[model samples]
Target: MTSGTADSGRVRSGLRGAAWLLPAAIVLVALNFRGPIVAPAPVIGDIRADLGMTATVAGLLTTIPVLCFALATPFASWVIARFTAERAVSLSLVIVLVGTVVRSIPHEAALLIGTAVIGIGITIGNVVIPVVIRRDTSPERVGLVTGVYTSALNIGSMTTSLGTAPIAAAWGWPIAIAVWGVLALIAAAAWTYTVGAGAAWRGSDHDSEPLPVTGPIDQVLDTGSVRTATEQRAAVIETLPHPAKRWVTWGLMLAFGGQAFSYYALTAWIPTLLHDEIGFDTASSGASSSVFQILAVVGALGVPVLANRFRPRVIIVLVAFFWLAMPLGLLIAPQLWLLWSVLGGAAQGGGITIIFIVIVRLVSNDDDARRMSAFVQGGGYLLGSAGPLVAGALHGATGGWTAPLLTVLVAVLLLGVVGSVSARKVR
Candidate 1:
């Protein structure tokens, strides 16, 4: 054999090894996605008192990151596609690390800015995760990994939510936020090791031919500077076919987006709604909020078992019915409805899992999968940005949640519509 062919074979071998390391990186980053945002929720009061933030301002502080997801996603996608996924992951860790340090400061401005930075990092990682799992793992294992990965995201969020307050009490909020920097550093190290191993394997190969997945890596390198891979991923998605034309794509979008509307909206405004509308005390309202979050973690963890046995579409249909009932049931009966709220959050928690699964199954190829994933999340989150804010505004204008509740009620119905279609046996 020619030396060129031998070198090429060796590089391919190395690349395969690097690909295998992807899941661990994905799991770690998935768990870390909501850490920056959720960790501070439990300690907001202290931050408020210490930083002199008003309620409206604190609301902005939270919303700033959500808005970044909407705005930064396109750029983030472009980034992931341009630099090679592993390099993109590495870059995002730096973003997270920088953001964490910034938030560690006592100033409100710095904290909010840092939150936006972290959101940008997480946004890229979030959009790409399913694509990574779907393309990298064997198809038979997808359901299980999807479940664990989604669960990790919720657990990560829950971990921060539950642990952040105590952490703040011990080290102060600055240190609390800063501590996450260590997590980012660890993720970055693992990813670097994995990618380097892949490159080493390839570099040592005797052949000079490019790898199969070189398209995405070259696209990333071609589209953007080495620094902005997430931006590159976003750019690549805009140029692709509408994956929604496929049943799985649309179904996942509807189910997932509808679920996100409820999840993000309630998480944003639930405490206020309970406190203001239900006359619950501040502590009681916050506790109620935590219940929703904690239960979501449970739902996320539980989806894989169901998906493994039944057809994914069938499972989606059942999930859809349950989802439709949750919010509508709450609207119908508001008496001691904290349990209902928790139930709704728990059901909606599956939305993230469904989103991951659908993207993996919908597209026929890796490029399509990543593009579809970006489009769905990009569109879904843009819509999600409106959910809580619009609900708040509608309630403000109407003087009751009548309009807002009805809207979510309709959204619940539509979620089933989209999910049922997507869940249909993928063509």
Candidate 2:
């Protein structure tokens, strides 16, 4: 009787410890979410001027981080499975801190290397946050937590995008990059304090599964189950939602991919685009891009609220119809269309938020959601990663911006089709 009591007490204490670490780790990871990617965008020109580089190289710099996003997600599933979600996320933040510090070095080589590392950190955070939420929180609250997480991610992104440029303008670019490290370190400290030294706690009502961390080697050798191993590998590549889900997944991916491509191009080069095309100064461009991002947050916030009140598909279709005009407006009416661009971005972000919210609710279990998340993002970002670079490359290759603009026009139309498909009522 005493032995059993002691074991129960130890288990109870462990769960208590995990409860604190779990949420703290989540919020900390969320803090670093957009720090690596968008924060550096505003400083692109500074780096270019310093290095005497071309626009193509600039595109490569942004492309590298996104490519990491595409690549890192597959590894994330393995990461959470092996180390567990909290540990995987905690370790990713460490990478973010280290990456930020490294980028702060005055050398161009380190900047590239550090940026990629920071992206790797963000990638893990992106993939695991959903899984952790499903595992730890109650079913009813999943949608709410998804919104909160999305909000946290956007908040981090907006801060980084807005903060980095001004800092780089005042201090050296290295200092600007390094400044974000403080947040990462603070996140790490908060996480460690909350969880103490061990993994997150498991409650009695929970069916405690292993966290989502596993490397390829672990998959091939450690698991030793050919069936589960094959499924894991496939999970990263294809989402393969059922008949009802098929169009929805493709539509979300396309709509997401389309706007994402455009947004990346716009945010990365809006200042340059306006400067080269119209005559706006850098400050004006930055302010405009910041406004666009802020509106995106508004759209993201509207997703759950609107979702609860309306059919998810109807909301999606409305957003899609609105988004169709963004690229067209940019091409035909630069003066009138910049506002359209901003509104389009917000619509896309909102659509994405609801897509994820539905995903949070629709899947049957935590593991399924994790697999679905990895597959959707992996494939989605594969398309998404290509958009910005292609736009930049088109401008470089053709010696004109018109081709890039035209490409966005085509992409915008296609994305609408996808969004329409994604708006279906199937679970």
lDDT of each: 0.67, 0.67
Instruction: Name the regions of candidate 2 deviating beyond 4 angstroms.
Output: 1-28, 193-255
- With candidate 2 superimposed using the best TM-score fit, by how many Å does residue 256's alpha carbon deviate from the native? 3.8
Q: Give the top-scoring candidate (TM-score).
A: 2
The runs of at least 3 residues in candidate 1 whose Cα sits more than 4 Å from the true structure, single-residue gaps closed, are: 1-21, 48-56, 169-172, 197-254, 273-288, 324-342, 394-407, 425-427
Give the range where candidate 1 is weakest over 10 consecutive residues by summed lDDT: 206-215
lDDT of 2 at 418: 65
Q: What is the TM-score of candidate 1?
A: 0.77
Per-prediction RMSD in angstroms?
A: 6.4, 7.1
lDDT accuracy of residue 419 in candidate 2: 60
**Model 1 per-residue lDDT tens digits across residues 208-283:** 5533323344453452334353454455555555675555555565566676666666666665666666776544
